[model samples]
Target: MPEFTRRDIARGVALLGTMATLGDGSPLFAEALDAKTKAALALVNPELLSIARKEAAWRNGPPLTKNYLNIRKQIDGSVAPPLPDIPFAKHSIPVGKGIPDVIIYVINAGGTKRPAILHTHGGGFVLGSARSEIRPKQEMAKALDCTIVTVDYALAPEATYRVSVEQNYAALKWLYDHAATLGVDRKRIAVMGESAGGGHAALLAIVARDRGEVPVMFQCLIYPMLDDRTGSTRMPPPGIGVIGWDVPANVFGWRSFLGQQPGTATVPVTAVPARTKSLAGLPPAFIGVGSIDLFVDEDITYAKRLIDDAVATELHIVPGAFHGFDGAGADTSIAKQFTHAKMNALRRAFGEQSV
Candidate 1:
């Protein structure tokens, strides 16, 4: 992807801010929007409006069930920023007898017994690869002086929730078992991911807790797609899901991953983190989401439930932000602060002094 200089981003934000309607001349929201929702919509950070417009166009595309392959290709074809100079390696570890070996990429800053994170990439569970995240993971490793193991779990419609979740668990097991060899401190292992990946991380934490094989010290969920019911049975307010990652795409993604319609009683509680019975015994968590994002309500409820269960939880609701705003508006001040907060949280989780 082409790099956007500060001037370029500022200019685009300014140009997009003056427009009342989308590029296709459609109203940004429905005419029936409530007074309170209208007020909230007006506060949407102008820097993220450009991304929201693009996401709206994407939402209008062909149904994911019919066009998911092409969409996956588009996501995989996008150019990533140059990889930072760091030690990177790939390995395939056997998950089980019949299950395929899980692939993982390890990005390390090269230190003895350093902190580590097992990260799952976000694509709503059907699109994305660990390779696509190497650059950012390398930068993160360099910045945090840690090692990051990113999993290439199988996608949905082809591979369901059980497959992907088991793949992630296998990766986590491998990370903990080989901690000494990888120069990682096993006691400091954390699980982290964004969007669907965040949901996967949450599930993995539950599995780790129940199985008692590996201990996850922390979980950093970034606007995690935790509840399948968000866009299905339980709809958000009028202005919430209208922007990036709307109801249709969310329902499709969940259905693909769950192998059934979301929000139905048949959906497994283990598959959807929000439906999990208890948050007790789970690791400390940092949950971050945008005020208008589709998953905002579910994420907040999960954090509150965690607190109720006596878990250490830090919840951040970024005002005027939308799903994936950090990536879309990385140069914006809000995005920078959000990233800083996440890193600091991870730092503290790893028992390192916060910057």
Candidate 2:
């Protein structure tokens, strides 16, 4: 029973350190708040609201650039609750020729060959690592009784889109190749991620489909940052603005990761999944996002595309939630329900009886 205080919530959300980039004079995606959004806000749990109020200040401050990279390290380095006492191992595998080794976190609860998860962490593509994602993966490993592997792919501005995607792709191949040794049932493996990692998971699924080598049974994207145009050209619904990572910060991340400004022709289709024309032949997907979060529109459209392409999809839109709602607002009923819904989706996907 790890109870998160208000400060802890702020720090955890701050680990991404991109969502809090909104300033007063900046343009808003929505002219005014929608009735439903307002209602949702009112229904938010009190603890989350308190945390949001305190975290809001970060949005009004100066632009967060590479100079702010240290913020991520500081927050991640801080003391937090201990991870679950689960059996695990760490590995550094080569991605490909002339590339750096990718670090991976492997957690196994012994019994039988079980389902597996290939996880990616969220940091707007500029921050975070496998270490940053341990807690949630630990929870999933225990809850689903599966082996979980969290990938430490290259970050942006240093490693461009090609490097990151290829590294994860190599990691996926490794998982498939070593499934027997890792005690993972080959067909039961799923790709799971939050925020930026969610987008990476989606990309990994596409690559798996294209290569026809690794078979990804499912994709779990939690409040994923899917579209580069989302931070550049997309206009959100009225009253749905500045809740999670701000536009400038979003653009900064996309630019750094893409190695060019988002929405530009230079950004190839392979670099951004939202730019992909066909969603058919992809794995079953679970896409979740907050209504007021910056990614809501892109996430919804992606889900619809998946459905239209006849890909099995489960989309959860939390009415009054903001970015990282479950992480920042973990103590609330809505957050609990939100988290439970994802776990249920996994249970169903893996053919386990619902809890």
Candidate 3:
């Protein structure tokens, strides 16, 4: 078997690449005497910390942006250790008149027809594909014992804002219409997304609710990038948390998604989910965000509002974590913690005991 790596060591190409550049100001700035934790972690897996430092410096330069974008594409194309015997189907679902068609990664879960999760991949809505989301969706299938449909939604810069949301809504409607065919319990269907995907999940819930179309059972917003218009939180992120994500990278991601300009207040909820004022009557939600993410404050506030509105809402604040920390790698304690939390949330939602 291939050696398992640390969570932070995997899937953190972009995140750690950016962190190592801060030099003396870096949160993980290394010291000579640090032992035990570092040594133990290093013993389990080696070269990650050093590799991250090199990768981080390169990430700050212009060439790094090109390399980073290229890496981002690779990430989309690769989902860990491709699935077998899972029996899946893929189909194109029409979204809008001008928007690119949405694709769904369909996996058949043999059992009594049950709930399904419409997963959206993160990458600031500019990168990441259904393929990139395969692993997590597969995990969800094994855990939730339900069909998991992942959307190959439109990306920005090429597709631009609103197009993705429009496509996601169309995909949800398509899924609802064909629920019986897919052996899915339409009423138990939930929308779960990570980062940009999470933002889309929130948007999908509202859009569906507003259109009086399909009912969204739950919204799992994991480290969501809500509003492209809003960057640099009004309430400052605590200084001591994970610094893998800094303001510059967050700004870069938003700009990449917006396609026009980064800080334009003109951006709509179709682009930035947080821009939508009426989040009431969406659905029960499980909101998970890291303390270091740019969207932490917004996500936390959104969760509180959902609760205040009497929606059954669960918010988890992962300590010393950055945005998109879920895919860090399976080798770290944090990764296991995230997995357990994810499994528990899905289990509870699906009426199963924690696995």
Candidate 3, RMSD to the unseen true structure:
6.2
* Candidate achieving the largest lDDT: 1
Which 10-residue window of candidate 1 scores lowest in summed lDDT?
11-20
Worst 10 residues of 3 by lDDT: 39-48
Q: Per-residue error at 21 for model 1, in Å?
A: 21
Per-residue error for 192 in candidate 1, Å, reads 0.3
Ranking by lDDT: 1, 2, 3
For candidate 1, write residues 230-336 as lDDT tens digits.
98999888678566566777888899899999999999998999999998999999999999888899999999999999999999999888777787677788999
In order, candidate lDDTs are 0.80, 0.77, 0.65
Give the range of the ten consecutive residues with the poorest summed lDDT in model 2.
Answer: 20-29
- By lDDT, is 1 or 3 better? 1
lDDT of 1: 0.80
Q: Please list the residue runs of candidate 3 whose C-alpha ends up more than 4 Å from where it truly belongs after superposition.
A: 1-10, 13-59, 63-68, 229-242
TM-scores of all models?
0.88, 0.88, 0.81
lDDT for residue 152 in candidate 3, whole number 0-100? 84
lDDT of 3 by residue, 1-355 (tens): 1122333333764233342223232223333322322322232223134332332333333332344455454454344765775667889987767777878888764466778888777766656678755665776686677888888877665676567778778878887888888888888888888877887888888888889989888888888777654444443434411234445555666666666656666654466667777777888888887665567788888888788878898898876455555555445566578768866887777666876
Candidates' RMSD to native: 5.6, 5.2, 6.2
